[model samples]
Target chain A: MDGHGGRERQLFELGRLVKAGLTQPLGLMRPGGVGRILAVRSGEGDVERGLLEMGFVEGACVEVLHHGFLGRDPLAVRINQAMTVALRRGEANAVLVGPLLNRATDVEPTTDQESRPS
Target chain B: MTAGTLAAEGFRPARIALVGPPNSGKTTLFNTLTGGRQKTANYPGVTVERKSGLLKTPGGHPVEVLDLPGSYSLRARSPDEAITRDVVLGRQARETLPDALVCVTDATNLGQHLRLLLELRQLGRPLILVLNMMDIAQKRGCQISTEALSRQLGIPVVTTVAMRKHGVRDLLGQIDALLNQAPAGDGVTAISDWVEPSPDAIRAHHREVERLLQEAVVREGAPEHLTRQLDRVLLHPVAGPLILLALLFLMFQAVFSWAEAPMDWIDGGMAGLQQWLSAHMEESLLKSLLVDGIVAGVGGVVIFLPQILILFLFILLLEDSGYMTRAAFLMDRLMSAVGLNGRAFIPLLSSFACAIPGIMAARTIAHPLDRLVTILIAPLMTCSARLPVYVLLIAAFVPATTVWGGIGLQGLVMFGLYATGIVGALAVAGVLRLTLLRGDRQPLLMELPSYKWPNPANVLLGLWERAKIFMRRIGTIILSVLVILWFLSTFPAAPEGATEPAIYYSFAGLIGRTLEPLLAPIGFNWQIAIALVPGLAAREVAVAALGTVYALSGDEGAVTEALTTTLAQSWTLATALSLLAWYVFAPQCLATLAAVRRETNSWRWAAFMFVYLMTLAYLAAFVTYRVALALGGG
Candidate 1:
């Protein structure tokens, strides 16, 4: 797909997931996004390869720690309790993710989403 | 792989490679095992640091330990990783295939490290798994069964703290046992057995690592939360940058303020020694050489050693405490705007002290373009070597009047010089990145390791290494240039009693007079021309050269004080300002060029650096001089 079309398709898929409890592209998640990676999409060179080697694979939990001070173009993320990796938002877009697992309750919410639990 | 095959070959030291992911205490373990007996070289054509050390086993068998660059897997991306993979697989022509591999795994982050170990295991080398940072893991309430881990992986497992003295004895003992068992100089499998791991193969390797961890490693819960809490504040968008700025300010302040006493002592000592030598030794070439040549020139550069150490102390501490990566994270956005990597921050910062270590430090930056761009721009930072020239010029010309908030004008101008360096570096990096280094978007998938108290031993070792490297430069490059400058200033017997001091008739004087016309537009006199020649050895040597030139020209009093006053009285304000501008943009040191050559593995880049910097220096000085002259300062 073309860039804009692919983005639209991802958003559509994210909407479908919100309705029917499934994974979505990580780029669709908001700033405080936290979820387990479904899969890392192919393309790009060192960034993709480095992410894979850093354990950003299927079933690995990822959390967007924070964004850059200015443009917020790059984001810091923690992967699988192993490491915190910083990447551009465009680079983070490759990792497809599922919904965040509710920690205390061990439940996956299927409906309305919140940025963080109070 | 049989032990019986190696027993007949006699006691050739067994070669062992220490491999691990970055920040996994691999280096600390290497230091612990090797003590102070480590040597660093480059891996053939690549600039990746090849570190090796000698160790004697309990059985008196000598072992050669090589610390390969920290890497995640054999699927190499960066030059560093490729060197590691090549060395491990015996594909490197200059390196021997290791008799054994010591896979250093961070106990706190085994899930990420075990994959590398599993991949190494497939190579069929004798492997000893080192569970480094075990103390941290235990403190976090994680339990690991070494026996079970060993049984599962079919390799000996050893736990090590790596920082404390006794922490690595068990590891050493285990390594000795493995060595004795393997016999001496047993050859490993051929490089042809290595396969390019497919995505599926890597995924399977990850799965196998997960399975191994599940069977042997246990924890009460998930990862520690302390780091996350700390990051909430330390990595905060606004607070993070502020803290970094504050830390940098504090570091610069310490470098200048704390080094004053020691600098004074060194100055006084050198002057006293020079005076005593002049009094005792009858007027001869040896006395002149000892006093003016050695003491004045080398002593000038050596006095800044304390300041260099102070700067490196902070850098080493930040690196050891795991905050360097977070600093990189904080810097990524700003760096990426200039088409550089976040990892380039530390090396560029190190350039403020000196460019050699800074260029060496650039090895940590993975991308060749980013690393080269960083190396090219590193010399642009206002290194401590330039501090002397800046201080001397500012003191001579810029006023000491205090401005807003009691900040002295001299201090403000010094800060401006440093700021100019930053601006120049940024501008050059922007242009170079656009034109020369243009390529794919430089990715920064940097791993910010967990924060820990900076280990004192590791910090000391790092500082010691820095100190040794600095002193080595002083002894070789600075010393040679100083001797040559002394000879240039002294030769031809002063034309047999020619008035206007001895140097006026010497070869150096002639060269200076000839160069004076080219430099005159920038307001530089023949003496300034003389200083600029030797100044190429090092930026600070300009101060020393100026001192020697004035002394040879029959100026009275101590070199520094007399030179400052003489410069203020003799040269136009335009000249001083122009010289300051020159130092700011010039490739102030030939050592920096040599470092650039070594790091980039090409004299072409070094030549390009020299030409570009010289051009920038000339243009900047011309502009500054013309503006100052036009403003009626001449």
Candidate 2:
């Protein structure tokens, strides 16, 4: 049940190469790109609560909604739905993520989907 | 615990608890209500102390005001909040429940602040609502009808601007009115009955409150245009972080730039006092005790007053102007990455002053693990005590060279030290989160208030309180430790005609010698080993201890020279650098460790904290020392 598309598979492979500590992947992550939750390096509690609270639970989707212009630390992430959260790059790297395929339609829909057309 | 036991023993006094959310001007109101008649001491049985002051109601009835920690609701997570919950519920073993509660809420931020009020209301305690910071609401073009709010809440509502001291008379009048209303011939209501309403119920309550607010309160317009404009710049995606960094940089710079003159003045004054005592008094043990013990030891700690004051000045101003939350929001991402909650920003920031209060401040962090982790790691954050040593080292050694165009090299080093603490704290938090206290990361939910002008009174009061606390420590803990160190250094009067300084013959010297081998791997010499003994009382005491040790080890000429020059001549650059690194992670503050023990109520956690910190300190020092030596800097 590999969920990644071909492009995502390529990015996942790339992420694997870069995944050493939290220092690599400098050139890979970009603002507005969707990413898959590859793995969570830290356990639950405040850190996990923080992640879940910010909507970064395991297997959930996330997108780099914004980036700082200068330092690579501060980042704004949009988790599943339209929930936007700001984080420092140091914090963002803790959540291991692989690139997502078909980022074009990743924009969160405004209305609840309970009654959406099938 | 003590209060309740004493009360049970028939020492009961009419008790009143001050309760409010963060940023509701609760502390300010507490200060006003209690004034100088207050005493701050440990709570009976629990290390979480209660601050109480005696006040007389307008009817001249005596009342004891207990300033409970600011808490948002009864769903307690942090120890401080738990204390509040326990005290209010009469659950604490040592303290009795308050006879009545004063629920303080921000007049302007009623929408969110009132949730706590609603929760407190459910506690069924006889409570009065104090609408604090009323002036701010008025300035923000918010008009709240006091009578209507009182009617809706079924509690007497009195408006107060705590900062300005306005509405105190009316508040006292209200308190008198409430006091006269006999307690319905029934005891205090049980807080457990206030199980927070279900989400749907809460939402309905909110809607009802909103409707009431619409009828009773009128907003002239949106908040002030200036506040919005300031927020636009302060909270900007691109600019917010930069501004925060710039503000922090300036704050550090100001600590050095502003405090230099005052610090020198204080140093000179101490030296003058020493000289006067030497000239006028006989060469008796008393004279030596006063001069060597009190002057040297206490003087060392007192010099840090300026730095502490300056640091707190920035904190107070930031808090007053309502930018502290914005700073937290800006840093949330970074904090989360390091396995810390964004709510930890305030507590971590508080550590710069002292870890005790900082640990206490962790009460605001909503997650138990987050709060615990924060309390454990807070001591590593380079508190004010370490500043004196840092300033001395940077002044004596690090060349005043500018990098990045115009930034002062000394200032940059200071900034680096601060960053090192932050980094180390994060690393520790990361490890702890992944290992011992693994759990889900708490969401970083925070309220960002509209920016406002920092009240001068609050800033001044904050500085005054910090200054007084620092001075008190100097007069008490540091002073006692210094005097003891002085005695240990001066006693068994150096063997007659000994070439070495008299101190080497004393107990301190023998102990230092014995400990030197253990510390040698980290570049600490015999003298530093000796200093470490007293350093446990407070980190900065090590600096003074070193000063006294070196002064005793040499002649008048040596005593006059700066401590750094002496170090530079005696030790290698690597040794000095390693010492700096060690201080960054040093488990030297007993008070902090004691605080951790008290907060966690577990000796195992306390021991773990000590071992972990000492290990990090040694490793950091070992690497730095060895690397520096390898670089041929010695």
Q: Best candidate, DockQ-wise?
A: 1
Task: Please provide, for model 1 over B310-367, each residue's C-alpha lDDT reduced to its tens digit, 9 standing for 90 to 100.
Answer: 9999999999887888888888888888888888999999988888899989988877
lDDT, candidate 1, at B449: 86
After best superposition, candidate 1 residue B98: deviation in angstroms? 1.2
- The model with the greatest lDDT is 1
- Model 2 stretches astray by more than 4 angstroms: A1-118, B1-14, B34-36, B45-49, B132-153, B161-167, B189-192, B214-224, B353-357, B387-418, B543-566
DockQ of each: 0.32, 0.05
How well is each residue in B445-513 modelled by candidate 2, as lDDT tens digits? 454455668877558756776666556655665666667777787777887688766666788888888
Candidate 1 accuracy as TM-score? 0.92
